[model samples]
Target: MHNYFILLISLFLLSVSCNSDYTPKPRGYFRIDLPEREYKQTPEKLPYAFEYPVYSVLVNYRQTQPELYWINLVFPKFNATLHLSYKTIDNNLEEYLNDSRNFVYKHTVKADAISETPYLNAEKKVYGILYDIKGDAASNTQFFLTDSTHNFIRGALYFEVYPNKDSLAPVLDFINKDLVHLIETFEWN
Candidate 1:
């Protein structure tokens, strides 16, 4: 009787221990689904324009200066956003380029967990600064595109999130392609 009771108690303890430790795994991030390439030109009313993903919607933001502006290209289906903004320098073109560069300079020194791709190979009529920034998820992909030669048009992309760098990596990587699309297809004409 004693032996049988001991055996039953042992089995019960083992089962309880195993059950306590078992936990279902939490889900990781969902896969990023990117669309195929497509382009549409902007109207002349735009300060400077380029082709972007047709699925993306443009929302204009308040201008910081008379010639400066901000806009957002939101992908509602993807729950992602691309914030594009512009600033026209009063001085020569070089000044605008330099101003853009300096913004990154201050950012680099002060930022925490920042990852930058400082220079991008922007095509003619479009070139400036590019930074692959990640400090806050709320602050995703902060980069600048320029009409490199004339400084007539300079735009920046800021992703909206709290800087969950790990969770946001896929979207950031995916958007870079479209950003490249904007730069290459850029036309000052």
Candidate 2:
């Protein structure tokens, strides 16, 4: 009789607990720690020069036939790199501009939206367009700076990880500020 009563109580308790509504919590991501903003100027030998974040390491882009001016600003912490390719204008400014436009638009298929912001620093003779790509694209930011006569530089920011805008928003925001600073301080050398 005692065993039967205990069993009845256990079943009643189980039934009562199951009656409460339960909702599963959404997924969560790990916290990201961003570094403080600090910049160092590029070496003078390059055709162009700009200030890049101190946390990033400047390395030459490795290719079978790499140009002297093609380099990458690698952010090890974020596993991201900003590729900068320099081209010497030889009456081909229009071609370079078109190439840059095409590169940005290529992300349209995966990009939620793409916005272009023209950057002009007449005193520095720096004119370019900054492409801000929104969504799960391979590249989130791209820009091209040109002197319209002798120098043209195209830059694209890419991450090694899978592209998920939601998880990458904070890092993207942080890097965007550095990019702006780099563009603002850019000068032909």
Top TM-score hit: 2
In candidate 2, where is summed lDDT lowest over 10 consecutive residues?
60-69
Tell me the alpha-carbon RMSD of every candidate. Answer: 4.3, 2.8
The CA lDDT at 179 in model 1 is: 76
lDDT of 2: 0.95
**Would you list the C-alpha lDDT of every candidate in the order shown?**
0.62, 0.95
Tens-digit per-residue lDDT, 1-189, candidate 1: 999999999999998887656679976987777777676776667767788888788776555434335667787766677666565545576776676566555655435555555444445545544565555434445556555444454445554445566676776677778877776666554
lDDT score of residue 48 within candidate 1: 71
lDDT of 2 by residue, 1-189 (tens): 999999999999999888867889987888999999999999888888999999999987546426778999999999999999999999999999999999999999999999999999999999999999999999999999999999999999999999999899999999999999999999999
Candidate 1, poorest ten consecutive residues by summed lDDT: 118-127
In angstroms, the error of model 1 at 47 is 4.1
- CA lDDT of 189 in candidate 1? 49
Q: What ranges in model 1 sit over 4 Å off?
A: 1-27, 31-33, 61-70, 92-95, 102-125, 135-137, 147-152
Which candidate's lDDT is highest? 2
Where in model 2 is the C-alpha error above 4 Å? Answer: 1-17, 20-22, 62-65
